[model samples]
Target: MDKKKISILNLAWILILTASLSFSGCRTDMQEASKTEEIFGTIVSVKAYGENAEEAVFAALEKAKELEKIFSLTISDSEINYVNQNAFKDAVKVSDEMFYLVCRADYFSRLSGGAFDYTIERLIDLWGIGNDWARVPKISEIEPLVGLHDYKNIVIDSQNHEIKFKTDTAMLNFGAIAKGYIADEMKSEILKHGVKSALLNLGGNVLAIGKKPDGSLWKIGIANPFNPSSNIAFVEVADCSVVTSGNYEKYFEEDGVRYHHILNPETGFPSKSGLAGTTVISPVSADCDALSTATFILGVEKSVKLIESLDGVEAIFISENGDITYTSGISKYHFKELN
Candidate 1:
């Protein structure tokens, strides 16, 4: 991918960069370095504060780019494409990282009862939402792909680190959760260089490490699904990841109907779960990223119940009418909705 400006219609989280750096007590003498690049199909930027900030941020971004080569669906030689092409004929051996992430994605698939299916790639291909040739498919075409969300059909061999598909037609897509894992890995890479404080914006998945140079929480604005250029709310957080998912970001319109990219594996269409957007907050970006997409498909009530059951995971759901609902863990002290 090529580095470009973040389009309002494509990102659901906006880092209030200037506001975050404006804390009164921030240390003025700390060294800082930042860089932005296009990777994982989104604008990824990293900023770090420390003596090694420059080297660390660059290394972290390089790590992200390297990971993308192994995971991206569109990359012709990626492990994902190799599996999709040949896993049905034989168990495909993969790297340890690939196996682990596949397992994590499988766990989320089971937890959401298939709402977070990674095997929904067939449907994603059919819709082709972000592609130039995107279109609405007939019910007949969508029917066969719906059952592909049966994630159990994806067989994993722990001993051999292989991935196999019981069904010939099934394909895997990690568009929802891979970025989170990548973000976490990038943070680890930064820490390895002795950087204590940093901020990352991978697409719209914002992860704050430690705190701002001023010892204040990072400010992240939740994009308004109805108005992508503005924020409906903002959160102050430290050492956490804030990820948002919505039907607004990627979509195609036909005959006055807008079809978004968050396809419901059950329906093989854009989710009609009555939620316009969902934002997940957690210390792990992978969980936040996975939960954001899954909960958006689960709708408000089920999402609320499910989030409450999980430890350290909180969610904010925005209704189709622009009303907001959140989990018990969220309070005005750290999270606030704008008028």
Candidate 2:
């Protein structure tokens, strides 16, 4: 092995070197190393097609941690959390990145007609819908909290980078948009480091930044909402984002009814819309991710209109009963079946 080749810090480059060594008829025990990943409670597997892909994966993980630190509501000092925590106590100025995100959240809240809101955290915790043990909150308990979560009330002073809530009870949570942004940011940073291709499969939110090693399009799978483990369809594309928002994920059952995490801002409860899931494919995975949640909250009719208005974005809607609906663009890239 070339000592200089080993010094390449990018994992994608490293993997290529490994493969070339194998193809060149050289014998070396498969290089092995383990690095703990800090995002989503799972150690992300790093693979390389060229060289230094291990370093790229580790770098991605590092980037994910930085995002986590900035966005975590659990942390008292994170700008978003700090603003929410300090609301009605004292005004706190935020960083420009934090300021922009707060502004973006506000804009999306308005764009989606308040369907996409960050202040739904109180209701989320009350129902425990995202957690393993789910509990139902009484209407009495939720009614008061729902009144507090008006996204229009999130006042952003862009010039000063300060944000404040109109109501004392309102708090912020970035469950919908944070992961997609992290993936998108990681992709940009990875590319800047000279990697031409990288695939990030964050649970089901998949983004392919570059072409495959064979110079073909990247093939990504869309998980069936009906069955979490299996995919209902596959999409072949390069440099696109495929994000799914489903009623099946993060849900709980009580008696005979099932409750899921995606909530209606109006009612502060699981949206009763008939759609099962919605996938939005765009150049921006982060936007697709956030809009998927927003579109689901908007229901089928409104979501269809939203997708149509956006350029270069395609969509697929999966109904609660497994009816598949496709926009013009996604129809072209659809995979017929799996072997």
Clashes of each: 1, 16
- In model 1, what lDDT does residue 293 have? 94
The residue-by-residue lDDT of candidate 1 on 64-98, one tens digit each, is 99999989988999988998999999999998879
Candidate 1: where is the Cα deviation over 4 Å?
1-28
TM-scores for every predicted model: 0.90, 0.84
Q: C-alpha displacement of 76 in model 2, angstroms?
A: 4.9
lDDT against the true structure, each candidate: 0.91, 0.74
- TM-score: which candidate is best? 1
Encode model 2's per-residue lDDT on 1-339: one tens digit a residue: 586666765676879988897877643333322344547532343333445556776777788878777887656666666667786576678766566666667777777877888767677767877666678888898888774546866777777777777776667777887777778877876776667777876656887878777799888878788886898888898888888999888888888888888988788889877888888898887788888899888877888887888788888888887777777666665644443
Off by over 4 Å in 2: 1-38, 41-48, 147-149, 332-339
